[model samples]
Target: LPDIEGELCRIERVRDVLVRRESELRYMMDDIQLCKEITRLKKELQKLVSIPDKDKLKEDREQEEELLLQINKLVETRDFLVDDAEFERLREREEDREMAASLQSKIPKALAVQGESDHESVI
Candidate 1:
């Protein structure tokens, strides 16, 4: 009887650990989803830095040289901006800011709803 009770206690302890682990897994899954979302946004933002020349302006010698310099600079910046790690950082930061802003915006509305519910309960 004592061994069986000890085994049951051990099983319950394992069950508790499993439940806590499951909750932690769920949170990690959310983080993974957030990372995935950040990746997609980074891809989208990188797409904005297109590698195409769309200007069809004719230029004098000085103007053409200036144009070329500007184009080169843009190309270099685009190259740097399109990096995976850079994009990932930018996307994650932007997502965090957006999430914060949304939470801020919801606060007032949530307060209003809570107030309404409280008033209704009193009535």
Candidate 2:
């Protein structure tokens, strides 16, 4: 029973690691999906993998430069998107800050004064 419990704990740890790895992969996939070129490269790579002939490999080698160029373009696109997303986040933060400042300004000073007076009366 003790050995079984230890094995179960190990399995649970492995499952946790696998879950985290899967989530990381999902995030990577989502990121890749933003670039159409990477998707095309992936499809080509899959096709290459499926074809198990030396002749096909030689022919595929001819397109390697094109594939790499597309991959690099995709990388550049991803970098631009990351920057755009950061910019959008900062914009949202600024908007939220402005809203909070506006709300704070509108919160009645008269109510604050009345609350102070009430507190004095209670004392």
Candidate 3:
């Protein structure tokens, strides 16, 4: 009877361990699935956002290059009259460039924050 009881206890311990391991595996599977879903959603979001903006971004870049070329030509000529209006226009363009740069810098930080929030929410 003592040997039988000991065998039964051993079986129960093994059963418990197996049950715990099964639950842990299920949790890991769930985590993997969630990560895959998050990755899919992020890709979809990027596709949606980037597709339309690509053309616009390309156009803007071309325009900026043209503007830079014109500015360089003006500088080379050294005969450009900097009236108040021209000066103001140049200053405004510089400000716009600065603002665009700052916004571009913030975009990655914003995405990082958003990613952190998403991870926290998943947990």
Candidate 4:
């Protein structure tokens, strides 16, 4: 009878230990689920934080496009100015040639008149 009682006591102690261990495992599983939820929330937060960066990048791209357009317009204006300067230079050169031709024709007439006056005085 005493041996049977000892065996029953050992079984009860083992069952108690197993119950305690089961509770500990339940607590650990709950902790694991909480950690997973926290990790998911952190990822969501990171995505939310990056939203502003994405918007800023989009705005920067738009500004860069506007600047490129302005640069192209400036280049076109510069090209027009260069062409106008070349045209003005060509016009001035033509005027100078015309003036030189007129002066040459007048010089020959004046020389012939002087020669005639000299011959009359000599005769």
Model 2, runs deviating above 4 Å: 1-32, 35-59, 109-123
Per-residue lDDT tens digits for candidate 1, residues 1-123, read 856975985797678667656755665565566556555645544444342345423433345455455555555544554464455556656866886687689779878998999999999
Give me candidate 4's TM-score against the actual structure: 0.49
Identify the superior model by TM-score, candidate 2 or candidate 3: 2
* Strongest candidate by TM-score: 4
Worst 10 residues of 2 by lDDT: 19-28
What is the clash count for each candidate, in the order shown?
0, 0, 0, 0
Candidate number with the higher lDDT (3 or 4): 4
Cα deviation of 94, candidate 1, in Å: 35
> Which parts of model 1 are misplaced by more than 4 Å?
51-123
CA shift at 9, candidate 4, in angstroms?
Answer: 99
Give lDDT: candidate 4, residue 117. Answer: 92
Off by over 4 Å in 3: 52-123
Candidate 4's residue-wise lDDT over 8-106, tens digit each? 857975786676567556655655664565556455445545566546566655655565555455556556655655675577568558856876897
**Candidate 3 lDDT over residue span 1-123, tens digit each:** 856975985797678667656755665565566456555545544444555554656655565556555545544333333243356556656866886697699779978998999999999
**C-alpha local distance difference test of each model:** 0.60, 0.71, 0.61, 0.63
TM-score of 2: 0.49
TM-score of each: 0.37, 0.49, 0.42, 0.49
What ordering of candidates by lDDT runs from best to worst?
Answer: 2, 4, 3, 1
User: Which residue pairs overlap in candidate 2's backbone?
Assistant: none
- Candidate 2 at 41: error in angstroms? 1.4
Say what the RMSD of model 2 is: 15.4
Error of 1 at 58 (Å): 25
